[model samples]
Target: MRSLHPLVVTPETAEVVELPAGGAFTLLADANHTGGALGANRLRVGPGRDGAKPHYHGLSTELFYVVDGAMEFLLGDRVETVAAGGLVVVPPRLPHAFGAVSGTGADLLAVLTPGVERFGYFRRLARVQHGLEPFDGLRSEQDRYDVHFVDAERWSSLRGGR
Candidate 1:
């Protein structure tokens, strides 16, 4: 059996940040700490707010667990509405997105197996390492860190076959 660490993380070590679409998220275990083992995150979306844009990983599997509030998942032609304590799995290369349906935003826990290299993506959006600044500023600094924007063509390819 695998041994469990008494304390792998603590409140002081948790990384928190505000995301796009007026949502906020916290990073429990990130790439730097996990050595790319996997990425785990907690997200809180306000009422009537959508989650991340419809996108898919080139080679990564992701899971989302709804901790509170009501959320709607959109995967291809199918739509699943889930409440607290529900889970959603998204396969790699499958376009999927979600949003809050209830008046109150939803609290979610997201996990990516084998790590999604999402840290690089979030870092590009954040610009500064310490805190999140303006999006325009982040866009300017993206290429400096070798982060490139995903154009519509590339995004479309991923969105297809959903």
Candidate 2:
């Protein structure tokens, strides 16, 4: 049974899950709502906040659109600074990570294609962020979420101790 209705997620109706990094992850249309076509969410980070550490999806491509402020992104071996109105698309298996540019807050919309039913992932992530659950608890679920964490030398050096 597939739902064919258009999905509408208003700000008030959307679920906002707070993260540990002075930020929040707003859950939007997920695979269940979109017939698995897309998974969407809003990621809002405070000044100098780190949104995600280096990781790559094994099955889903990711798209990020900076709606406000600036964001620093590590794509593969390069680090890019994208201002508001900027867009970055990452195909599956491409190492990537993001955070607010130093001293600035960042608001962005993130979408995953072939939606990965990731609401559970986001919720568990919040638990990890808030210390409700150890990161080790979430580590084993990465494969289920399609997110495979990996070390990126470039990202590590730049984000080290910061």
Candidate 3:
């Protein structure tokens, strides 16, 4: 069933998930909140922190809007730098990744369309990062989250080991 009324999330009411990789995510909405239409979250990463690895969604489009600082992204085979107020739209099956620059931090808004329940996925990632769970566990969950991890040697080479 879909919601007939609007849903609003304030900063104080947002759910915050701290990543073991040196950042935090403020979850604004998820599949349940949007009736599977979309999900939104704010990501804040410290300098030199990896936001995510190269991966592709099987069924959703990922849209990123940089709110502050700068973020370096691996969009398909290209490396691009998106600063504050910049936007990047990635279609399904297009491999991509992002992180804060070496000496600067970043703040961005990420939105996924055709929302899938991904809060659990993010939680699992935190567990993996904290050594509470093996990365193999996350590998098995890719299909469930629609996120398929991919090798990013090209991106690493371009970033000079970023």
Candidate 4:
């Protein structure tokens, strides 16, 4: 059995990465910090910002807790609106995407179970968005991050191309 240890991450100790799309992710706790149990992050997005494109995790369940404002989610084949104080739990292999409402920004707490070290992935994403790297590079890392992107034209249609 593994020995128990306490992990504490204060705001000053946490690492924050700013994405090119006017959004940010603050790493709260990761697999290494939590004994491979889970990884957590705080996501903040500007109005109309896309938090994530349609994707599915092959080995981890993702959970989102809305802290403030509204979030529009495309879960599976349906589009749902999740408001502040709401929660959405996505099981592994379920297609999902999310964005802040057109007129309102959003703050969310996201958690992934049986965590995969993803800080590097997020950092690479930022680099791509900022033109420091090619987007194609991310394709090769899909399996490493456990995030597989998918087409979501139906979801876009549901949002009326918002």
Candidate 5:
């Protein structure tokens, strides 16, 4: 268990990773920092860009708050567009995905409860997007990262099979 205390990450000390898909991820806190209580990061999505593919966490609840522009999200079997200042929460085992709206960009903050050390997962995402590693390499790491990929026909259709 982690001690009950405060955790602060200054901008100059935070880790930022650029993605080939455009934009970047500013990591705030990982499981280790929070004693597995929470994980947080800010995502800056480029215009017409996808933030994450369809996936689910078996043991964590993920929350996303749109800070700017608009975002498209696939929750369970529905697809919806949320604007800035909107918040979406997904409980464990619910498949979801998100991205910036076409022709527009998005900025959002994401948090996971009972945090899993996800900074490494985000780092691997950048590597995969940059072609430094194959996507298949991640298949074996789903459990370690607490992210399990799933096929979402609705999401595929919405992204036009991108």
Candidate 6:
């Protein structure tokens, strides 16, 4: 078994996780931890005062375990109000978005299978070094990824009419 001290993992060295609509995220593996095919992370998201335009992933599925505060989840057309002890599963491109709707921000333990490549997608969008060309404005800057919003109920099968 591979073993690494948790102290080995530091914010400056760990990979940075960012999403256009989602919040910031950080890796949780120890510097020496190993033997797993997937990566784990402790994600911290703010109010998300401005909701993400509502998009879905086609290749990767994500899971969220709420650690603190309350969140307003948009899973398809149905909105789920989740609290600190909530758990949410989102299938590939199932049209999901969430943010803290009340009180303090949210802390969650997020797991991504295969790897953190999906996190990379959002990282590329938020990085200032990338020239900020890939991002489409959510509530500002009219130029953004063009997407047709659909009701939450139809999120699972809602990729049509693009």
RMSD in angstroms between candidate 4 and the native structure over all alpha carbons: 1.8
- Over the stretch 1-162, how does candidate 2's per-residue lDDT look in tens digits? 356898889989999999765789999988899988899999999888778888999899999999999999999889999999999999999999998988999999999998988999999988887889897887799888998888888877786645
Tell me the tens digit of each residue's lDDT in model 3 across 1-162.
565769999989998888755678888888899888898889988887778888999999999999999999999999899999999999999999998988888999999998989988877777776788997888888998999999999877755664
**Candidate 1 pairs with clashing backbones:** none
lDDT by candidate, in order shown = 0.65, 0.89, 0.88, 0.87, 0.92, 0.55
Per-prediction TM-score to the true structure, in the order listed = 0.69, 0.94, 0.92, 0.92, 0.97, 0.58
Best by TM-score: 5
Which should have the higher lDDT, number 1 or number 6? 1
Model 6 ranges off by over 4 Å: 1-13, 16-23, 29-36, 48-53, 128-134, 137-162
- Report the Cα lDDT for residue 50, model 4: 79
Question: lDDT tens digits, residues 19-105, model 6?
Answer: 443556676652124433345677676653322336665544667888987766777767787889999987865777666664457
Better model by TM-score: candidate 4 vs candidate 5 = 5
Query: Looking at model 5, which ten-residue stretch has the lowest summed lDDT?
Result: 14-23
lDDT tens digits, residue span 1-162, model 4: 221898888999999999755688898987777777888999998888778878999999999999999999999988889999999999999999998988898999999998888888888877876789997898899999898999899777755554
The C-alpha stretches of model 4 lying farther than 4 A from their native spots are 1-3, 158-162
Q: Model 3, stretches more than 4 Å misplaced?
A: 159-162
Per residue, candidate 1 scores C-alpha lDDT tens digits across 1-162 of 222433276767877677654677677876455665677888888785666545566556789999999887766546678999999998866766777875668999998865644555564443433355554564464443322333334323433422
